[model samples]
Target chain A: MLHSVALKTLHDQRRSLVGWVVAVVLLVLMYAAIWPSIRDQPSMSDFLDQMPEAFRSLFATAGADMSTPVGYIQIELMSFMGPTLLILYAVGQGSSAVAGEEDRHTLDLLLGSPVSRARVVLEKAGAMVLGTLGLAVATGAALVLVGRLFDLSLPAGRTAAAMLHLALLGLVFGALALAVGAATGSPGRSRGVAAAVAVLAYLVNGLGGLVDWLRPFQRLSPFYQYAAHDPLRAGVSWPAVVVAVLTVAVLVAAAVWGFGRRDVRG
Target chain B: MSSAPVERDDAIRAEAVIETHGLSKSFGHAVALRDLDLTLARGEVFGYLGPNGAGKTTTLRLLMGLLRPTRGSARVCGYDVWHESTSVRRHVGFLPGEPALYPTLTGLQHVDYLSHLRGADPYPRALVLAERLDLDLDTPSRDLSKGNRQKLAVVLALMPQTRVLVLDEPTSGLDPLAQQELHTLMREHVDGGGTVLLSSHVLGEVQRVADRVGLLRKGRLVAVDRLDALRARSLHHVHATFDAPVPVAAFAGIDGVRELSVVDHTLTCAAPEASLDRIVKALGQFPLRDLTCTEAELEETFLAYYGRGEDDAA
Candidate 1:
């Protein structure tokens, strides 16, 4: 029954999902194809060293010391491509969960059914997780292909873990979006709030990585818990996973409880 | 048409499909419904009559578990509207005043989605209703006209195999032929021992399908009686044109007569019932040119309650 609901949601949103998937795939291919040629330049090491910490924080860690043939792949894929993919999925899924229903005026229709309001939110969120998971798998395969063609020695376990980490991060954002969607009950306002929150978190996470004062504020952002390179390539952060899980749980619970009691007349 | 009288108590029996006790709902300073007590017996086609903003839609929404009441309570098939909303929702088929359906989906998809939510595949009934109503299943809702949208809503509400129906202005957008079809459909449902609470502004529609009518003014039910009884209570306006000026004094002291006016050579009398024999006999002495009589419409009686300032502000 749960799967049926999720599948219904997917079929309802199949057009939009297909469009996003194609766009993401093309984007990944373009970046992956263009990135291999930039790895061979002699000035690459000096350029990596000269790069500002803030700029480095925006994408991934780039440095002369880590400038091996494989390091080029690490700096580009882990820092830049991975987080961008994660954020895109997060924003897309999060805004669509509640706001999409409001847009279609199906929220009232859905609520009018035998299903509980909590189940609607959870089911849509679950569908988003599945979609993001699919995207992650596609991105991982594309990354592996790019690595092989470019002669970049990418660790299979670490790369797969990174993709999984990104997928989980997307879910966190998606759940937060769901909460916003449920609370506001307007697609435009919910999407705006979710975007603002996601962008703010990303900024805080970036600044914390670059500056010392903002480091303390880093704990507040969900991104701080998702250190892409360290997790997949080096080691896993159990604390970060716990914190992410807790954040998702609290937001979703609050959303469901709030929605359950709300007068869903609209 | 006279048959055995149905007891008022049994008109709404214990096997009632819907019951509300003092169900009051208010939006901030505006009172939508106040002390609303309603009961719909099994197999009865009930009409809920009220003007715009008379809390008709609000009442239906509350019954469907779409809106929670501010005070008091209601039960659908013995299931609490607020506490056990899911159970209540499962058994009730609701047609909102303006059903905001998914515009992109075809008529078939609309039925499929609604049935899917109810945890039942309502394809057979949906197809039957669509064919009966002449709704094109292949066409998307946006492509359909207002009447078709209403048809889709009706199909969605009726397709579900539920005993109780809470329909609000179900036939508002349909054409005359479609309206006739809907009336036939509703009667069939009632004959099959299904209950329906149809809220509508059109009295003729209600009179045709509803055995009992509940007249609502503002947020309160002013009259709840048999449709025929309610009609019998309304005044009939009779006008008589004489060849010469006629004295209105002869029609005096009549039981049902409320106001009598004579202008030029015409005598106009507004009364609960036209005393045709007395009126004609009295006019025998005079040269009566023309006589026309019109019974008060149910809407007029409804307006009379409201027009007299009976909670018009509500």
Candidate 2:
């Protein structure tokens, strides 16, 4: 089964994956724990309201209330830190899927077996998806645990929806990285291209609301689809979720096609 | 002896386990393989001999369907390599010149993963191979020495019990004992009616184990002959110390003799196997004190072929 490759890859990544999950969970819990202190200070909400619109928009908290649990978590965790960690994790795994095998000179041995090139690409992509989903679940669980301990009254459905969006967002970058890796057979190049896209998209989405000129290009970034509806408060937007899913599908198809046609150079 | 005709027919027929028809591969403008034709019969060990950059690895890649040929075609176990690669792979086992393994996986895990990929249970055979090769399966592949890594690769390729084995420099990093064990394993494999395409630059190893050898030079096959036939055709250095002065002319103009010379009471000549009787007859004319005839090594024979142009090779 193609899933066998995914299982094997996941097993190989088990140790490092635990570390990433632990770090993400700890980061989430640490941020969630501090929300109560900030929520108790009425002066803090006044200070946030007095802040310049441009400065607030830069952090994606312009229209949202800073004192509320959903608004605070969106600004401090979900909007930037959580999604960034998940995207980086997915991109790392996706880029390593094909290009890493070539870089390590292990692709030849793997392909020498009876497995098809398409299966290899698809299976590795499957592994990346699994890892990204695992990260999302870990982060979501941490958020829930800390929210309950701190009495933040976080809505369970909205939190799950937020995690679902985050996972989809990670899938977009992961699939892109996989596609680039398949075409180039170079992990460094794949990572560079994916990271460049991620950083540029992030900046365009974050700054688009603050600057009038960048607003037109904001929708072109995947971060717009992820953050536009604010899934942590409004629950999942089906259109944005569909877009993310379709983008991942297209990129994964490209990866499998490119990998099937190219020579196993390494 | 009674199966010779049947085996010959099997080799010529479509039943040849591994066959290539004018297979060629080019990397952009540089040709790696050109108009190469090869055939291998079941239960035979065919050595593919060449120097570096002689397309030995390229040919193996083409047969494995890792590289598509620019022209013609190749088949393993009667399946076209490029078109039906999965089927081809199902019947053939391959070991590359350098075996690269997953670093984090222990030797046992690597075996398990590969076997899982192939949809076969290899543990039993793997255990036997580990014992034979003296491999430690618990060690991480990253910690294994080069020789151990090679042993792991060998076990992976052989454990599947595939019909054909394509091994490129299979003994490159093996210790002497391990190398001997590999040769024994290959012999045993062939004895079980398996075919092997063994590619290497080591002439002595090929000469020791291969029933037939194909000498490749500059991406072209220079010669493909049985070991005995190649030995017969190869030049042998003959040195004789005579009791009396023997005319060098007596050894000249003989079939398969070349570079005849006489210095003092010593006579020296190069002769092929066909001229042995005639040379002995000529040497009998003089009272000889000592004589020695050394057959040219396979390396020297291949070197001679390597020095020849394509036209000469053809």
Candidate 3:
């Protein structure tokens, strides 16, 4: 069938992909447009320093600076907004992969083909991965390209590393959504599970710095791997990337395994 | 001439394309299907008849491996429906009741994608089916009429010419003209040594092409017989207007009488072949003003068997 499932999935997502890309470009431009003004204000750095320690630890990464381009992007985009956009897109695709089809009563038509269940799950997951990665590249290109126009320059290698970690963070939750969707053919419920777990993981990673008891489990959170080492500053962390990649791989395998064993909702 | 019928019967028995052994499915305590042991052979159309929610859809989905059985097993083309579903699907074409299609895709795109998924180019066959069914291949499914959508579903399912056709209420949204065309297609499918399992609550939908019929009720198969055999015992509507008011007791104990009522001077009821003479005799005892005896709809005959009760077919 020439990877028909994957190709068809991507074809179905063409419009949504464009919308997400355009949103990314516009968002990057807005941030880049504001970088010049923020850099010109020396008093902005004092305002951040005077903020409560808990607020700084939760929202601002280590070595917070309002004047520097990398720190500004890290505190503003990398800390929250970037991951939110990517995770939303990934979770959307993930939910629609299997459970959303079932919810729409189209799973029967798709599975009516001679393809195996494992192949369907794997191909849909592949399509989601490709869509997420493509969006990540667009975001990176937009950040670098848009940054130049506003006199805000960022290190190329570190920006790429940040984009890589952000993509992995998105993939982790996307795969989780896919696994939950495959196990239970309920789109709303699967998305809810993924979003709730993501919020909890974000809280654990962010609040872990100030909350003593949460420290041991903070590394287990995907957000920690995404930003605890701050890829925008120190560049890529091989160990964190491996952990994020492995989490996605395991979740995809679980999707195949769960889907193979259950009865597909008609 | 007698040997011809025997050879056809032998041909049917020679190939059991669809066989189920004590297949059962349940969603918790609510049993959707129970111990379904049905066999469909090549060169025949078996009409699976039932009212809505009679587990007709459940059986069809099970045969397609869309729903796994809670107990027992089924095989299509000698392939296990659940364990070897991919192999089973390669040989079967299924049209679910109210078949869903991608809202944005055109009929041709569906044909292209589904046929490609089957790993075969059935585009030519699909084009011919679409033409014969008078379906617009360029219209998006969401924009098409219900009848047109159903026609597209038929085109997609029938394109492959698979060994077995599992159709659920295939004619629900079709016009009489399209229904006739679909029936003809089904006949041709069997004539070419393929098997068709056609499910419908209305017996007329499948009677024109079905050689045999199976009635399902509350997830249980209540009756399975040749279409003609069921027709032989088919219920007949007996309506009579008497000159005088007739008591209900006059026809209280006649066998096979259903929907029986003697309201004042009018007596209206249905009875099968065996009870017709008794009903006629009972009418004679009263001075009859008018009498009308006609064959009931095939569905009425079927309902006379299992349609009465608190209908919770789901």
All models: lDDT? 0.74, 0.84, 0.89
**Best model per lDDT:** 3
User: lDDT by residue for model 1 over B74-99, one digit each (tens)?
Assistant: 98887789888877777777787777
- Residue B107 error for model 2, in Å? 2.8
Q: Could you tell me the TM-score of chain B in model 1?
A: 0.86
User: Model 1 misses residue B35 by how many Å?
Assistant: 2.8
Q: For all the predictions, what are the DockQ values?
A: 0.46, 0.52, 0.51
What's the lDDT for residue A42 in model 1? 55
Would you estimate the TM-scores of all the predictions? 0.89, 0.91, 0.90
By TM-score, the best candidate is: 2
State which docking tier applies to candidate 2. medium
Model 1 ranges with Cα > 4 A deviation: A1-3, A62-85, A209-213, B1-14, B140-143, B243-249, B263-265, B274-287, B305-307, B311-313
Using DockQ, give the best candidate's number. 2
- Pairs clashing within candidate 2: none
Model 3 per-residue lDDT tens digits across residues A77-109: 888899999999999999999999989988889
Q: Candidates sorted by DockQ, descending order? A: 2, 3, 1
TM-score, chain A, per candidate? Answer: 0.86, 0.94, 0.97
In candidate 3, stretches whose alpha carbon ends up further than 4 angstroms from where it belongs are A1-3, B1-14, B237-291, B303-314
For candidate 1, write residues A126-203 as lDDT tens digits.
Answer: 777778788777777766765567565567776677677677677677777778777766656665776677778778
